[model samples]
Target: MASHQNLNFQGQIPGEFLIARIMQIHASISKLESLRPSKQVNILFSHLVKLCILPSSIDIKALPQEVQQMRQSLIILCARAESLLELEFATYLSKISLPLNDLNRFPYYENYVKLAKLEYGALIENTGVAQLKKVAFVGSGPMPLTSIILASQHMKSTHFDNIDIDETANNLARRIVSSDDEIEKRMKFLTSDIMEVKEKLGEYDCIILAALVGNEEEKAKILGHIRKYMKEGGVLLVRSAKGARAFLYPVVEEHELFDFKVLSIFHPTNDVINSVVLLRKSLIYT
Candidate 1:
């Protein structure tokens, strides 16, 4: 499972090692930092643990037929690596300001997180005043960055609910949000499987789906639930992939369902590859 393979965020065939190296260094520093006292860092290795780096691109050619067949599994492994590394890095951010995290050097993972949140913010800001009342972010992981941004902006007058089935992640998300007074005042974390939350369906003007959620069956089930409970004309924003293999999450085409009409599609300017669909719930669900 630890076999080395060449992969890049843009599907570029870069034999480049920047992100891969950063992940290795991050894991190493995390361990090293855990051993030393913060007041008087170990003279020998203190600053070494604070290193950061970014990405570079390369070009290439055809993949073997067998490799093509295994692309999905390869992507799944990549997604898992990204999620675990991201969670670890988000934990690191807890110790200092976000800027101090040096987003450019840490751009691969951390900026991915921030842009996932900001993609929705761009839409909400354009929405008419008080139009975006209550908001729910499903599949919010340990950071709940999207919910934090919305609560601090559009949903400030109401509540921003972050729901996920993972209890540990929910707790971690709560701790992260609580650190910010404004986000804490408006954001709430709930550890409940989506199917069990009927009331949550109708409680918001908007719903943002996390990209990590699995297959078509699971998404269809959730969409069915949304059809039943979502308010008429409410917005449903889904994070998807347009032209690349994403980790554990399946790359799906724009949803073909009767309950929601495609309002527009948004791609992050950074070209992160995760596409967001802004949909409006149609009154009729067949």
Candidate 2:
């Protein structure tokens, strides 16, 4: 991890300085032919992630106007970095003859394992739902590791609907888990925008919104749709970010969650990049 001292913040928020570093990193990342598993791209992205997590006391909104203006662009870049990595890994895994039990050989597999445990623990602790019969993961992307880890390791009997708007991504996800008979039997991939499947939302006992699913307004719209259609008292695990991590991922605002009963909002201060918000659809919609 890059030390905050290296940036020389001098006891004040490095607003423009941080923006300059971000732009420099963006320029480097943009120049890459592909954000796949490469030493250069990995180092560049690691720097960007480190910059976002650097110790900072000021809220993201309080940053300079120039930095604030670049927040959305930063979020998009971060998402692209993550998506490209997943796509590359998924594509590679799909072509290989690796067994499902060997998935931990992937470099970033442990991150998903850690994240899955954190989320599953959060769900059980906050919602008291230790056994989920049906769960849906919105924007599961090319590599649906969270669902895979949860279904295989935690909730073995649960059925997971991995939803993504991109059919190619869904196909890749399906192929990645095809070797695992147990997982393949339990995981179902759906290719459609989340809003398009509002009628089927009520089937899931829990739904997880991925971090890169959408921007703030788009996420609110999706959340509203889920709130209106998901079964009463069903839990929604929303991946969010707080502190400096907000620049890497969109932060779910409190105002957008008025319709749902907000149960718990956890901001991880450790290696976990995403914060999790646990909310349950109100039994009585107002």
Candidate 3:
């Protein structure tokens, strides 16, 4: 039996998805109304738990392909759970380089944790970890968990701060509340558009933009706008599905704001699909 309870906010799932599940649950219950009394009750409980728990469990992986597809849209369920696990046990795992015990608390962390344990945890075996500080996330979704995990390991502070213009992401961001100790103190969760947030964000030493825009034009526009806010000699790390070439090649030909140079290019060794591009933003000389 599946449960229809509202899941935690993580990555990209929105309230609409929850509403849809409720509708589906209602329809399923209606279907069982004509059945025998005992059968109807059993079916009701079964559907309830199936609707709720199946989407969140690791056992969903072992289920048939058809079963997985039904819940694919709700993938963010696992991501948010992982974020909580990492935050909950940061103190105990602070000494270890990659905290498997903590990460395994949630299901989505499996791939990332495996990569961290076996393949230097996506930071060149700790070099990138040493360099990270005051990390500011430009996008929120499943990536926040990964970002928070990285920040917990390396950065002095982590900010899941995005200038959300997208309604869906804004909804998810609104649901995210930080309870991870000073995480709330370090976090600047805001809902304004990017340019607007820049005014109050000051200049973060390390700014991370994870697929902040849709295409090259939007990316370029945001980058141009972002230059005004980035500190001198600071690093602006960007992750994109289109790859580093999308930003790096164009940045050279059009040096309007800050100079863009590709500092690092590496893909996450785990299950995530996007590649990481670390670009250094040269301070503008007046």
Candidate 4:
């Protein structure tokens, strides 16, 4: 029965149809904003998280590239929905759950690893950064994959610090990092909000900002606080924007960092249209 249903899904869920479905849900939420975040809509989002939001990595692995993109597009839609409706229905879907029975791995597992390498490489290859000896990751949620990847790449002398406002998330990230021996030796977690982070952890060559950080106002405040403490030429490896993802993962526009110079940028198409931005803290006289 399950096999038959999976086949049926593939038959109907073409690239265009999948894209349309996502747009349709987005439209519905926009039109029914008041009702969309209520209890009734929570059920709808739950179903989307369960049945539709997942990445069809295995199912569409051999399919056309376009179809594979559609599979990821669905994941993006669910992520956006969760971000928007979290206040009203925080528990509608849990953290990035592993697929049942060792199902499909992360949609872009290799791509993500590769991009993480590039983000690290950019930090090292850029002018100001010789070695990313001290790294800090902000807004690291339960699974601090970026921290793991970035931290793992460097030697033991390098240290990585990750902080999140959510205590639960901080604990989870710490546990996950501890499980991996390579990353565990260097990674540390702090349960503190980015805005309140006044500690002079010395000079961090690189600081990464997760895309899932809250709205623009909060982001500006965080940036402002960090700027006050960061050293000149200190690099910020931030997540930049792509099209409408600004609605959820508000991209740190270059304009926002009037005191920082844009170094380089990388874009990858996945759950969230993500851009790895490399920035250098600069002296701004305005």
Q: What value of lDDT does candidate 3 attain over all alpha carbons?
A: 0.45
Model 1 residue 98 CA deviation (Å) reads 9.5
lDDT of each: 0.57, 0.83, 0.45, 0.58
Better of 1 and 2 by lDDT: 2
Tens digits of per-residue lDDT, candidate 1, 1-286, equal 1212332355432433433433443344344434323322232122222111112231112434543344444444444554565466556665555522232343354545566565656565545445366788888877666565456544567677888888878776666665667667777788888888886688788887887775544777777786678777777888765322232245546545556777677654353556677777886542
lDDT for each residue of candidate 2 in 1-286, tens digit (9 for 90 to 100): 3434476565545656665677677667777887666898788877877776665554766777776667777788778778888888788889988646567776678777888999999999987878899999999998888998999889999999999999999998888899888899999999998888887999999999998887987989989988889998899999988877887889898888999888888887767788889899986543
Worst 10 residues of 1 by lDDT: 44-53
Per-prediction TM-score to the true structure, in the order listed: 0.66, 0.90, 0.47, 0.63
Alpha-carbon error at 172 in model 4, in Å?
1.8
TM-score of 3: 0.47
Estimate candidate 1's alpha-carbon lDDT, on a 0 to 1 scale: 0.57
Point out the higher-scoring one by TM-score: 1 or 2: 2
Give the least accurate 10-residue stretch of model 3, judged by summed lDDT. Answer: 244-253
- Alpha-carbon RMSD, candidate 4: 9.8
For model 3, residues 55-157, the per-residue Cα lDDT tens digits are 2212322444653343432222222322344343443344454443344554346544443233223343423554444556665542245455554554444
lDDT top scorer:
2
| Candidate 1 TM-score over all chains jointly | 0.66
Cα error, residue 259 of model 2, in Å, equals 0.6
Off by over 4 Å in 4: 1-22, 27-108, 128-130, 154-157, 244-248, 268-272, 284-286
The number of the candidate with the highest TM-score is: 2
Candidate 3 residue runs with Cα over 4 Å from true position: 1-108, 111-133, 141-143, 156-162, 166-177, 242-258, 267-270, 283-286
